[model samples]
Target: MHDELPVQESGPTASGSSPASAPGSTPAPRNPGRADQLDRRGGLDRLGWSVLRPAPVVCLTLVAAVIATGFAVRSSTAEMGILIWIDAHHTPALDGVAWALSWAFESPRAIAVVVLLAAGVAWRCRHLIDGLCAGIALALTWGTSYLVKLLVGRHRPAWTLLRHHVGGPEQDPSFPSGHATFTTALVVVVVMCTRRGWRVWIGAVGCVLAAGVAASRLYLGVHYPSDVAAGIVYGAAAGYLMVRATTLVSHARPDRRAGQDEDELRSGPGEIS
Candidate 1:
């Protein structure tokens, strides 16, 4: 979201002081107090403020919980159980639909497209920070997914042995589904960048899209439920962190109006006129 600063016209004031002082006149001194305050608020404080919001806190907690659960259950038995159940009920129609959905969101291209669209919207709205955050989030999601896959070293579901096998062979590790991660990250960026009035609609659509991508992974017998779940958690966390980073950087900029607003927020109610 963009915040408009009020425009100030240069002219004589009520006291008749010229708007432009003489070239030899001493320049107004910098506000030492403001400088001190800015110095005190280091990068850590900015980051803390960015992530201290309620929504981010909730999302971060969920991410931690999901990661913990994944660690606790090292085996894919739980994943296999769900996959088997889904396999038992699979139909040709479902397979066709899942295949189409899965094919549509394969890897970096679909992820890049979503990020680009979100960035385009943000740029159109004159919210450069939002656009940057979207791009950062997608980049982080992709990189993190690859790193985690390497660390976890989990194999993709062995669909060839199954009677209802429809999915093609996948070479990547399967602890976290990249498609799910990318789609979820995109959804998070879209939800955060959208205006309040249209946020609900955007969020709803994003949720459905994310869910469809996740489900497609399962229906295609390529990813286990746990993989998709972990991916979602990773993606959401990445998006949240990137958004927070953008906010922190924006606030930390040398903007007079922004500083005044921050000071007002910090001041007691009695201090406000």
Candidate 2:
């Protein structure tokens, strides 16, 4: 019988020379998959994109335009003329309703509703991209409002009266009411956060509140009609821009990341599985 040669078992590397040539040596190549997994995890577990891509920029631009236009059109005389016209036509009962609405809009109770809603959304949608978008919307509305108010320096109805009188409108210019801005912001924000028919419902509420606040400014004799009009324009611009910004950011977000994020979030909370 021929002498049996000792058989050497071929391990993964065969000659045990290179890790790359080993039987299961493709671990490094699998990094892409792992990275993909992590991306998904991040998307799902953390607030990733903010307000959809180019939205933040677009919103800022739009707000600037509204402010510019509002200031350019400021005229105490025009404001007073509108007040006079409304006062001349509407009944005292209607005015009273407007006044009541004005008070309600600024009340802490109204704000509380918005705060609660935001908080609830945040908690439920922690991993959702939209939560970040919602924050952007709120910030855009509020930031622009204050900036416009300061820049326009429009007087309130309470401080001065509108006069279509002889000397070309009053020097005390009141344009762009804060109350209107607040309500409009709330309405836009509410609409953005909800879906389907909810938008309509939210919009209706917002409109009512905005109108009430605007009317109160007039009733309280603190803001002119023009002020309210400007406020509406400002609010709408902020709302529209915010929505558009959200759209842009959504589009720009990396598609690969979103899926990974979702998967990681669903598979129990840990690092990327």
Candidate 3:
């Protein structure tokens, strides 16, 4: 018999040795659960950076300003003079306008409505981050307004001067007009959250609403000008800072798959053989 050549395995045989992947081949798909975990971790990291970067300084500054204004209003007669001047100039016809404008913010309902609307808009846009930011900003505005009102402990303008006012069984202290605070904060957040193409319209509408709310408080003679002014300042600051934080976090770098795809493309066959 011819000398039989020793049988040699040409490829992976029943022994089960597999071929090594090519050097530049695409990696195996990542585990779905593990990938989601990584994404969540990265999101948290971005959110932390966004919160830590500028929020503390800005918030502290705003808090100091609000505190100073609160003290000044409590200890001085200037604000009273301003309120008296505004009250003296009220017109009967304006009562309807003031009442209508002020009605929305008469309670916490208008703020809640705005928060819901903002969330709805974000959901429509498929941007969950925007919704979260809007909700957080509005909540912060409400909580801060409540705390500051408690801390300031200033009473509302005297009802005797409120001739053109609408109906009320009002009981809240009014160093900072809650209506003004909520409306201003709502406007700021709405404008900031709008897309560039829609920003002008949204901003214009927001300004109209905020101005109407502020003027309504003065016309109703329920809030001193100083109270509304402080509310505007505080609310605007809170909305702006929160929007900035959310924007920073939302702009985190895209998924790693994009980079991987680019690398694969660069390393793909130069010319199909």
> Number of the top candidate by TM-score?
1
Off by over 4 Å in 3: 1-60, 245-273
Candidate 1, superposed: residue stretches over 4 Å from native: 1-58, 127-129, 250-273
Better of 1 and 3 by TM-score: 1
TM-score of each: 0.68, 0.55, 0.66
Which 10-residue window in model 2 sums to the lowest lDDT? Answer: 264-273
lDDT at residue 119 of model 3 (Cα atoms): 66
Query: Candidate 2: global Cα-lDDT?
Result: 0.54
Cα lDDT listed for each candidate: 0.65, 0.54, 0.63
Question: Of models 2 and 3, which has the larger TM-score?
Answer: 3
lDDT order of candidates, best first? 1, 3, 2
Models sorted by TM-score, best on top: 1, 3, 2
lDDT of 3: 0.63
Worst 10 residues of 1 by lDDT: 264-273
Tens digits of lDDT, candidate 2, 115-181: 6645654555453444555555555665567677777776544333433221122234355665687
Q: Give the better candidate number (2 or 3) by lDDT.
A: 3
In model 3, residue pairs whose N, Cα or C atoms come closer than 3 Å (at least 3 residues apart or on different chains), thus clashing, are none
Tell me the tens digit of each residue's lDDT in model 1 across 1-273. Answer: 856545444434566453444456554323233212322321111222334557667866876675565555545555677788788889889899898878887765676685676568555545454456457666776677778777677778776656687766788778778888888888876665554456589778988999998998887778888889888888888767766665555445554444344433232111101
